[model samples]
Target: MRKADRPLVLDVVGDRVTVEHGADVDVTATGRAALVAQYSRGNVMSRSLLELVRQLDDGGYRCVVVSTCESPEPLVWPGELPAATVVLRRPNLGYDFGSWAVALDRYPAVAALPRVILTNDSMAGPFAPIAPLLEAFDTGHTDVWSLTDSYQLGRHIQSFFVGFRDGVLAEPPFRTFFRKVRVEKEKMDVVHRYEVGLTRTCFGGGYSMSTQFRSNDLGVGAENPTLAGWQQLLAVGFPFVKRTLINDPSTAPGAENAAQVVRRRFGVELSDWL
Candidate 1:
């Protein structure tokens, strides 16, 4: 297929473009892809994010990356994206959720695929090969899955990364919920309505949800975990460590950045995955 180029569709301004990687997506593939929503200050893309894209591409996923530029400069995507991945660039309006909604509405492949992953740049992960995790999730019985779940927000599946089975994707409630997503400028509002809301809606609609790391291992509320606790999350087959556990730019304060702490003590930088 040809390299993705700017197209005149959905909101466009200047050189900003929306593109999907492949012309024909293999909907029957056992391994699924991640619809990544990434944000940047300007034209340049994040190296870590690029590495993540490459890993997803190599891992047999037809990644549909949604790049949202949060700067005055027009989105000039830097570097070469894999031919197997689709990318869309737009103004950062509704944070990650908005980008996800736009990509789902515009890309038919996203809905047609049997297994779909709605994830973002918030985590630095797959320090080791992700093949094992992918194999675990390909079971075909999961209605919804997440690397990790959070109880702090009323037992809702954290929105940073969630898997949608074919049943959920092809249904009306899922489409209606995502399309109706309001663009909330406030981070908390988005968190409440989307991050927490999506999980609840899916469960309420007769869908099941689960997480890799059992919160019981982390204690009730599953909020503050020690360094060993973080390691155990990965030890239990959870892929992609949440960046906030280390240092979150959000107002929430944490003990330490797990990446930095793990590196200082274990000499292994999980974010170094490439």
Candidate 2:
């Protein structure tokens, strides 16, 4: 079948999803909120996932929801979703990266899918930057396009370095991984230092021109450190997009500015999209 004519099947698994073709398959079943709540505590982007699914549904993409949790719940949304969407809850069989690799090996169809868009949450709004990612799939620029957060630098540094040095990151079933790194205060000086010396060596080399706005959510602040790690990664050379504002009660106007900046930079209307 022609590429554009092919069905767009999105699998929303915990932390990631695998897509496949076939108009008969379901996408909503793979994006259940309960399954996501299993991996996260408190308010772990669950609302975001719900919103994302809604946007994708409006955009005319087929979705499927899957549960990788042990005692999976009947994944459901508070409001109505597109009728065309499908939902499925599978028995949670412990499947980490290693196990997932084995499963893909066994199910070649999963690995052989034409396009896949994997995200940790369903509420990622205005995913325009990812347009290139979808294009990459069509052009065969990569086998896997893993969607990542913009504020995670320490994680990216560790993952990328480990993968580059030990070749452990060179496993099968994934070729290109897209990570979004953001900028913040604690790491700004370090990033500037790198920009002066070894900028080209880092991912998305040099600091991002955009600034970040964070909310004063006690939970988010408690969980994520400053963006120093992200700055470091940028200095080293990884391509990333900034997630300007974090939705926290502590920061009110910051969120508004962040939304505006993101909209200006990416031409994505955060209010309209989110």
Candidate 3:
């Protein structure tokens, strides 16, 4: 088979991308290549996804299926795709980010035989104008790529900072605890006192560390039974209170920027495969 005619499979993870070959039994082995894009319903951006489908079709890709978190029925724009291209749908596993991790881990088995071109849903726009889909196939760098330039990177950073600040202010222990204590109204003093007791027990006793709250009501506040139960587990002999604040920027810009700075200081561009 000609190189241009080889199959291509795309594994999309919201704004992240990973690529692999399709399996022998899959559509790619039948000579018609496939480009699969995973869509999460929780994601607010769909325009880029739609554009990617259109671009792939225009570039003569065989299949353009959008796996969305909606129903089994995929949203297909027939006119936007070529006759050879087919759109199919599979059920999305709700709005869980972990679902994408599960999907990417399994993608190698699902589309292992065909030539793969992995890209993020966000890359669809930059790709739409420059045939980025074709570039993925041409350069053989389909694992992951950044579509936006440095300016957009700065904007994204600013937005993240603002959101983080707002989130910190709105956090339960910080906002709710302080607000109730400051408000001197005696209409429901007992309830407020009870809340203060629980808060004190959790934080003051060092039981709230590394604990996550689970709530029965989707909209209501969470309850950390483990923290509540931990109060009883503390040994009387080891009465030293050790409080640690877990703030990890490693998952975000701290590690990323550090790596970037190292590369820049060394006057090198980090290899993508690393």
Among all candidates shown, the one with the greatest lDDT: 1
**Tens-digit lDDT string for candidate 2 (142-231):** 222222222332322111001111111233313221111112123343232222112223333322221122212212332232232323
Q: What is the C-alpha RMSD of each candidate to the true structure, in Å?
A: 7.0, 14.3, 23.0
Q: What is the lDDT of residue 108 in candidate 1?
A: 52
Model 1: per-residue Cα lDDT over 41-158, one tens digit each: 6666655577677776776777877877666554444467777776677766677887787777766556656678888887665555666656555674778887666666577777
> What lDDT is reached at residue 70 by model 1?
64
Cα lDDT of model 3 by residue, 141-236, tens digit: 222122211111111110000001111222444334322322222423322342333334335433322111112211222322112211221211
Clash number by candidate, in order: 4, 28, 9
Candidate 3 Cα misplacement greater than 4 A, ranges: 1-26, 29-34, 40-47, 64-66, 71-79, 94-114, 120-128, 140-274
Which predicted model would earn the best TM-score? 1
lDDT of 2: 0.31
- Please report how far candidate 3 places residue 204 from its true position, in Å: 44
